[model samples]
Target: MSSTDHAAAVHQVHRDDYGSRLGMWLFLFTELILFGGLFIVYAVYRFMHQQEFHLAAQELNTTIGLINTIALLTSSMTAAMSITAMQKGNLRFSKWLIWVTIGFAFVFMVNKYFEWSAKIHHGIFPGSKDLLAKPDGEILYFGLYYVMTGLHTFHVIVGVIFFLFILRQIKQGKITSDRYVRLENSALYWHLVDLIWIFLFPLFYLIH
Candidate 1:
């Protein structure tokens, strides 16, 4: 093949990679707007019912929140480092780091499950007799708490699935040093998950 033709082909490949990254960023933008709407609702309700919100938030377990925060932050580090490892041509090490990040995600989920179970056992879920008797502000607070956290939990599950896909691609030799955008995009999504939780942990757990 002619040198000019080869150059054009290489340029097209990079262009496609850039296009994929752009698409991912656009999707992430939509996700941000989605959560932003929820944050606005939270703020308005908190403004209207400061005392009740405060009281209800006190019921959340701060210790679990803190632990999950650390776990996610650490996982974010691992996810980022995985890309670095892949760039360094340490493919095996990259895969291991991705698995570690997935492990942390599971830990976060387990902690979340226990926390929710405790609340449910105490009859604190929405529409339960105990929660129903609470003031409207507290009820709304718990309601949003369930919704936002539940949505975030779903994102975590999706992220785990995405990481699994990345693992499969890596094993199949589809993601590598020269073509690693998929891995980078996966890490970006995971970081977004961690970032959302950073905000969530403080708003629901520490604010009280």
Candidate 2:
């Protein structure tokens, strides 16, 4: 059938349809711009206060950041593979793979929890210089660090919620080879969260 027919078919049950995808893409573009601005600000600070930034970066746990990086990258691979599996009309495999992806997401958050807990215990909070034990100049580094990583974590939370909803849709037969837009878009969101972390790890953890 024609594209119009396919969309008309989806309109009945799929609230999003093509229009939803289009809207999501547009919204993602706005998010991209917002992150782009934050990145620019980070770059400026890093360049001007290179020494302090590097020292502040060293304050972070490279091991934890690296571990999370590996986890998220691995999850992205799993999610991509699941999409491929769905395209091949393999529901069981796709479902299992999605569950695996969610598992990795859980692991990533768990690691983040431990990492943040340690930081909090050490009293390294935003706008708390005595808490962080750093000089005034070094304050900006940690400030931006918290903001960027915190925002990225929020995105991860959103992605996890989205995938859980997709899991429900799959169980109820709302998603299948016949209609995988939900899967496809959820995968896209997951990938974006992963991509953000990739940039973040190097910027915040690898400065030294």
Candidate 3:
């Protein structure tokens, strides 16, 4: 109850917040590396089979891709709004925003499933699909498509889990308007997901 004891407690709280922030940044860095490798692969393919890739790109479901893009961008907006609510110490509002974002994310995933299945059913899938009846190595284009989008899907799944954890933290009173670093970090992750899709849309569905 003494002034010195109160000061010590405040300092400990600041230190704990700093540690959480640092951990989040470190994790973000690791995520950067994981996405980096995929970018490299995309570059190599773009350079190696520019024509085939372009042709393949034209075959992609651009409408579906654009729809998914909008969904993700909307989710990102909701996430940003959630963070703002958290900063305002409005936990209830923040939770609702988070739930809204999760809903959009799920919709994105479901749309992607349809897009993929359509391609797969048409025999335009990866690994020399017999469905499309394409020539050898021609189907390689679809191979890259699957790998890139598949990896991106995995990232979304991870983001969903992370978001759920953040919500739990908020519920437990571990997070507050005064100390919600986890929300910001989760936003960063969501933005990364959006960024990847931004590039992906053009590469897989808009090239000519």
Candidate 4:
């Protein structure tokens, strides 16, 4: 082998513990920036139509939003605890906790589906005749509401899939106490999903 090629191969043989985490963080940063842009747009529109925005937000059911907020928060706690359980070599408990987290995720989605269904039933969806007839500010409010919440719902589904993958790894003994970055990263992603909803509930359901 060429000496330069051999040297490169040797360098690649070393495992960098922080490298996986660093990559995950970088990916998360990009996600945050993407959401940040949406936040800016929402802010600008809200400022332009404060009263209408307030009125529009009132149509959302704060009760359901509150329930979802609690569910996501509890799910985050369970996910974090699962990682701890794994680190302590309690694979069975860790698996059980993750399953609970998945259950919470399902609850969140079901709540969201009902909420969206009710709004659509009431002709509150974007471009609906009711919405189109409203003032520009209210229209924008519902529009942003659908877009942001829809995206967040998509994330919740993705997070569920992510946890399922983690559970599979645990079952196969691929994720162990010493090598649990996959689970840790999934937990981080789930937390991000929860955090986004923290803002969303206030903006869309409670501000009125």
Best by lDDT: 1
Query: What's the lDDT of the predicted structure labeled candidate 4?
Result: 0.92
Which runs of model 1 end up more than 4 angstroms from their true locations? Answer: 1-15
Model 4, stretches more than 4 Å misplaced?
A: 1-14
Pairs that collide, model 2: none
The TM-score measured for candidate 4 stands at: 0.93
lDDT for 34 (candidate 2): 79
Q: Rank the candidates by lDDT, best first.
A: 1, 4, 2, 3
Ranking of models by TM-score: 1, 4, 2, 3
lDDT per residue, candidate 3, 1-208, as tens digits? Answer: 9999999888874446677767877887886788778778778867877777777676787788889999999999999999899988889999999999899889999998998887777766655337357633346667778888899999898889989999999999988998888788888888889888888888788887
lDDT of 2 by residue, 82-153 (tens): 888988999889988988888988888899888888877777878565645776547888788778888888
- Looking at model 3, residue 70 earns an lDDT score of 95
lDDT of each: 0.94, 0.85, 0.83, 0.92
Itemize residue pairs with steric clashes in candidate 4.
Answer: none
TM-score comparison, 3 vs 4, better candidate: 4
Worst 10 residues of 1 by lDDT: 8-17
Question: Which has the better TM-score: candidate 1, or candidate 4?
Answer: 1
The number of the candidate with the highest TM-score is: 1
**lDDT (C-alpha) at residue 12 in model 3:** 77
Against the hidden reference, what TM-scores do the models get?
Answer: 0.94, 0.87, 0.86, 0.93
